[model samples]
Every structure is written in structure tokens, then in C-alpha cells.
Target: MPPKRAFDAELQALEALRQATPEEALPHLTKTLTHRNNFLVSKAATLAQHHNLTALAPNLAEAFPRFLADAPKSDPQCWAKNAIAKALAHFEYQDPDLYLIGMRHLQPEPVWGGNEDTAGPLRSTCALALVQCRTINSHKLLLHLIPLLADKELNVRVNAARAIEQTGTDSSALLLRLRAELASDSPELLGACYAGVLSLEGPSAIPWAARFLPPEDDAAAEAAMAIAQTHTPEAVDILKSTHKRARDPWFRKATLSALALTRQQSATDYLLHLIEQDTQTADAREALMLSAPSPETLSRLQQLAPNPNN
Candidate 1:
């Protein structure tokens, strides 16, 4: 086993390499790829990817077989596989075999304890990586990924949903399946399904999604946020209606929070107005923070705060 000091040094070196430009650090990074330590190899892959080292494609391609062959028997190796997939997804290189490997990893395996909840991190990472595959055969890969929408693992389902959404293909059946899954009650699942639906059906999804809003015996904050994210005239109207009708303070706050997601000036004006109201100032402030308010919104928030100097 490597000594603590040696391991620490290796970590430091990888961090330094990550900060270095590809041009200045490619030589050292290429060497690190061959390191016996899985961590070092993973780090090298990540840094190469972050730098968009297209020049390193051949090296990454060479590393793919080793990463897949090793098969991650333990947690650390599993993490290494995840890192490798994460990096490869960012590579400009496109290979059908590599994409297939990613797809294979997305399938629930005995390694994942027969449940997606227990699936190794690599499964989720691999699912996401497959989405980045841009070959002519990529759409075929996506068609196979549709089954993963109902994956027991939230991570798998969410990533798969995002991948399908990115294709800009209609996924109404996929959305219906996701909504039927018992785990769809999860806020994360709802958010992913909504994202896919919005991409597939646009404003048409608003009314469909609003049925889950106002938290009727379920936490629908994410669903409401999804509606707000659409930023359509219809969506804004729904948010306003939901907020007006919300009887529970928490649900009201969630509705108000979702409104912050809209780019519409009306939404911002409402939030600003809430910030001045005694009953809503606290929730409004929190909602604005969550929304990542724009510069103009920031100035307005500062002006509205009782003590802007603070």
C-alpha cells in the first residue's frame, strides 16, 4: 500500500495538474494515466477531460478497455470506473464500442445489489456518459435507454431522463411511465420527469404537471419548480393561481419559490413585492437566493432589505 505521505503528494500533484492548462500539463497528465493507483488514473482522466484535451483522445481510448476490464470489484475501483466514464463523456472522441460499454454499465447489475438504490456510482455516471455519445448510432443507444426511466435507482432514472430530454425527441410514453413508477413520488423523480416532459411537449406539459402541485399529501416543490422553469405565459399563470390558493405556509413558500424560477418580469416583480411584505419577506428572501437572482434583481433586493448596509 502507498504511504499516507505518498498518497497525499499524489493527490496534491493531481490537483495542481487539474489547475494547469492542457498545453502545459499534458505530458505529466499522460504519464499519470498509467499510474498503478486507481485514484491517480481517475484524476488524470478528469483533468484531461476538464481541459478538453482532444489530443488525449487516443490515450483515453487506450485506457477505456483497462477501465472496463478491471470491472471495479470494490468501492474504490467502482469510483475509478465512475471517474473514467465521467471523463470519457467529455472527450471529443466518439466510439460505438465505448458508448456500448456505457450502456452496459447502466443496466442494473448484481454488483448493484439487485436494486438501483444500491447500484454503484458508476451506473449513474455511465448512464450520463452514454448521453454524451454523439455517433450516428447514438439515437439507437437512446431508444434502449428508455427503459431506465423507471429504474429503481433515482440517480439512474434522473440521468436517463436528462439524456432523453437532450435528444429533443418526444418522450410522452416515457413521461407516462415515469409518472406511474411508485418512486415518482420522490421530488427528484418528479423534477426529472418534468424536465423531460417540458422538453418533449413544451407548454402542453404545464397542465399535466400542475395536477401534482400544491403538495396534496406529497412534496411537490420540485414539480412546481419544473412548471416555473418553463417560463411560458401559461406556466406563470399557473404559478400565480397556485400561490393564491395555497393554504399551507410551507406549500405557499414552495409556490413562491417556484415563481422565482421564471424569467418573466412579472415573476420578479411579485418576488420584489413579497420582500417588502412583513408576512412574506423571509420566504421571499430564501426563494430569491434559491433562484440565483440576476444583477438587477440583486440591486432591487438590496434596496428592499431593511438594512442594505449590512
Candidate 2:
């Protein structure tokens, strides 16, 4: 577990941010980022946003003579960069201002993302900051980050895919390439790709994602249920077929319930059977019956298969 001091310090910093002006927060922000201790490193970026210093993105991008004057004073490059990214997000797309000042250093690299060793938090922080800015600079970020889809670390790839999804580019080629790059052999990678494509949604799901999901995998079942929730007539048919083909009965039932929605005939018997199952998943079974229930549907429940538990 992380130490309690970490949480307390972060809360205190956020509270101070709420109370102070950007200039006032500047000293504290710098102190946090530049601190020799690693404890404050994670929060530096978040602190920058709280002060609304993001409007200064232009100056920070170009000279940030202030931030640069201090960048060297700060020990970690990651900490400094993250803080700037947070500030840019606090403002929205104007990150070029900050990126401009740090050109020499940033030019060679462009943008940053998670790699094998990184925890998901920082990369996600950067991606969301970029997306909220909604600038073209971030749209171009895909080129820099696309490679990380195959990152050795699972969480890194997860965050990378999430970032791409946030950018909301339906780079069919990119998504397909990532899908092809992952083998059916590696279920984890398949799971990640499934998540990645599901995030993309739309008709893109049909030909592209159909192959990745097979009947009965818990993850695939979940995806089927999710697709059913879209309520597109075609999506509904596909989900129904997907569920029928699915070898996992319980998950298949869940998929049917979601697809059925107000269409009671579709799930009526299956849900009633599940509710009367007298099993460990009884809670889930009961919840499904309760959600999206119809009185016409309830009439069938009275005739449900007898269960000792019921």
C-alpha cells in the first residue's frame, strides 16, 4: 500500500491550490516538482493544473525561462514534463505554448507515453490532458504513441490504447494492425485489443472485431453484452447470434438480457430459468430480472421452474 503521508500531502496540496493564486501556487508547485523526494513527484503535474497556469502555456512552451530556470533544479525530467502537461490540460489545447519553449528537448522526442516500466497513471494523465485540449498537436500524437501498442508492459499498452481511443481517431489501419499484431495465442493481448476496438465502437466493430471474440470467453461474453447495449437493430441481431453461439451459458444469459431490453420475448425464459437456478450467481440473476423488467414478463416469473431458494 502507498503510505498515508502521500494521500494527506496530495489533499493538502490540492486544498492549497484551491486557496492560492497561480503565482502563489507557482512557488509551491515548483517546490513539489523539484523536491528531491520522490513522494511529491507524482503530484507536481496535477498541482500545475489547479492554479490555472495553463494559459501561460505559450510562454512555458517557448522559454519557460521560469520553468526551465527551474527544470534543471528539479531532479526528474518525468516530473517536470508531467507538471507541464497537466498545466496544458488545465487550459485545454494550448500545450504548444509550453511545448514550444521546451522545443530543443521536446523536439527530439515530441510527446511522451508509458513504456514497460511505467505505471498507467502518468501516461493516462498525459493522454487525457492532450484530448481535453482537443488540439491538432494531440491528433498527431498517435504517430508518436502508436508504437507503444506493442509495449512489453501490459499496463503501458492498455494506457496507450486508451489514449488513442480518447483521441477518437478511427485509424482503422492502426486498430487492425494492433489487432493483427496480437495473436489469438495470447489471451491477455486479445483481451487488450478487444478493449481497444470496443472503445472504437460503431460499425467498425463488425468485420474488425468479430474474429477476436469467440464464444464463452468471459471477456468476450462481456464484450457481447456491451455491444448488445448499443441498441442498434443490427447490433442486437449480432449480439443475439453471438450469445447463441457462445458456449458460456451464464454470460450468454447476461448478453441476452441486455439485448432483450424492452424486447421481453428474447430473454423471458432464459432469465426466468436463471432467477430460479438456486446458485451462487443468484444475486446477478435476481438483479437482471429486476432491471428492465416488464409486468408481462413478470407473469412468466410466477410459472418459473420451482427452486428451493425461491
Candidate 3:
């Protein structure tokens, strides 16, 4: 059969299995997990995860390394391996060894100018999974995760920071703070690190994060937004203070936007006060709308800045 036709047929079969009873689907799903076609294997693995089929855990585990053997040819974009790893993680399969192998796997596939590592997603999935393993101590987990913070892929680095955050130890928070200090580029990575520290240390780390809120860089913007996500009274006050001190128009606007995201009554009140001003009104309204304000807040917005269209 043509590859497309074969793929279509396999998909239809998987869909049918999805609608079948778990008992009826089990054998077929298990067989499909071993299919040579990566797409088919991915679909089967997703179905297993969807069904919570704990019985297929070993099958998924076995299939992961098969595609990793000659990854570009067998798994292409690491599709099969990524899916299988996710399924095992969903099962909460507690083998740090499997996750460690995947977390370190780098599949550099041919692209136009150069090769891009297709296994970044697989590494990210495995990093998150590795943290969840009950057998590994926090120190070992952080040791494994720290290298990923400097991974070639931005998403891999970001998720490594997030996985570190999940460890929730003072050591993990310190690792994040250290990464935040050393990272000069990639605001998203900095944002993840900032969020991790704030999450692990709570409001007290607010002062440390606030230090990054000056100089009007993307890192500063990330800091502002991270601070805003805390949604504490302290967060609101710090953002309010930052907004007042900001000289750059873009940074000032960014601060207002961050304030809206706080979802605090005080932040809402500050934004409402800004809406009354001629210069700040449009930016403030745009910020509130983007925040997805509560109904009462929306009503207040409608009153103050009556939509010309309405």
C-alpha cells in the first residue's frame, strides 16, 4: 500500500480502538505500540495514556530505545520516542534510568543549513518525568536537571528550569537564582528561572526578583511579569512602584500590563485610576481586556471607558 494510504488506514483503526472497550482494545493497542511506523506508534502510545493502560508501560518503555537507535530515520522528529516517554511518565513509571537516558539523548537531524536536535522535546519530557521518580533523591535529580538549563534548545532550557522548580527544595531555588543571574539572553528562560525562585521561596524572594526590574530590558519585563503572577499585596505594591519609576514608555506600558495580570483588587483599582487619564487610558484599557477581568471589573471598565462601538 502507498505510505499515505497505509497511514490513513492505521489512523482509522486507532480511532476504532479508541472507541472500543478497554478489554477489547488492549491486545490491539499493545501490538500497535510495536509498529514500525513512528506515527502509528505515537498514536497507539497516546491512546494507552488516554486509557490509563498501566499494563502497556513496559511495552512503551521497550519501544522508546528502538526508535533511538537510528533516530532520524526511525523516529524522524523523535515522534515515537517522545510519545512513548510521555505515556510512561503519565503512568508515573518510576525508573530514573529510562528517564535519564531520554533526558540526555540528542538526535541531531538534517535541516537546511545545519542539523537541529529533534530530541529536545523528548529530553524535556524526560526531565519532567525524572523529577517525579520517587527513588531518586532531590540532590541527584537537581544534578541531572542542571545540565539541561544550558541545553541548545530554548524550550529544553525553560522546561529544565521548570523541572528544577518542581523539585521545590531550597537547593532547587538557589539553582534557579544562579541560572537567572548568569543568563544574559533569552527572556523566556529568565522568566522560568524567576518563576521557579518565586514559587519555591514565596514572597520573600520578591525583593531579589525586584532587583531585576530595572534597566528596561526583556529580563526586566520578565521579572515584572513574574512578580505580577505572585498576586500578593507585595506584588501589587512593587509593580505600582516600578511603574512610577519607569522612564521608558515601553517598560512603563509593560508594567501596566503586568499589573493587570495580578488579578488583585488593588491592581485593578490602579488600572482603573489609570483609565481615567487621557495619556494612559488606551494602554490601561488594553491591559485590562488582555487580563480577562472578572465580570465586576469588566463592568467598571465599561463604565469608565464606555466602548464607542457599544
- List lDDT for all candidates, in order: 0.69, 0.52, 0.91
For lDDT, candidate 1 versus 2, the one ahead is 1
Quote the lDDT for 97 in model 3. Answer: 90
The residue-by-residue lDDT of candidate 3 on 264-295, one tens digit each, is 99999999998877658888888999999999
Query: All candidates: CA RMSD in angstroms?
Result: 4.3, 7.7, 1.5
Off by over 4 Å in 2: 1-38, 41-45, 48-87, 96-116, 127-140, 177-181, 184-192, 195-201, 249-310
Give the worst 10-residue stretch by lDDT in candidate 3: 274-283
Provide the global lDDT of candidate 2 against the true structure: 0.52
Q: Report the error of model 1 at residue 205, Å.
A: 2.2
The candidate that wins on lDDT is: 3
- What ranking emerges by lDDT with the best candidate at the front? 3, 1, 2
* Residues 166-200, model 1: lDDT tens digits: 66654543644356345434677667777668757
Error of 3 at 175 (Å): 0.8
lDDT of 2 by residue, 1-310 (tens): 3757776766577566757777777766655554444335445555566566664555333323334343434423445455555556566744433433332232111236632222233444554454454455544767645665665556555656666666666683356346545554344455555555655666556545555457466556545544554445655556656655766667655565555552434444545555567442343345445566677665665555333376
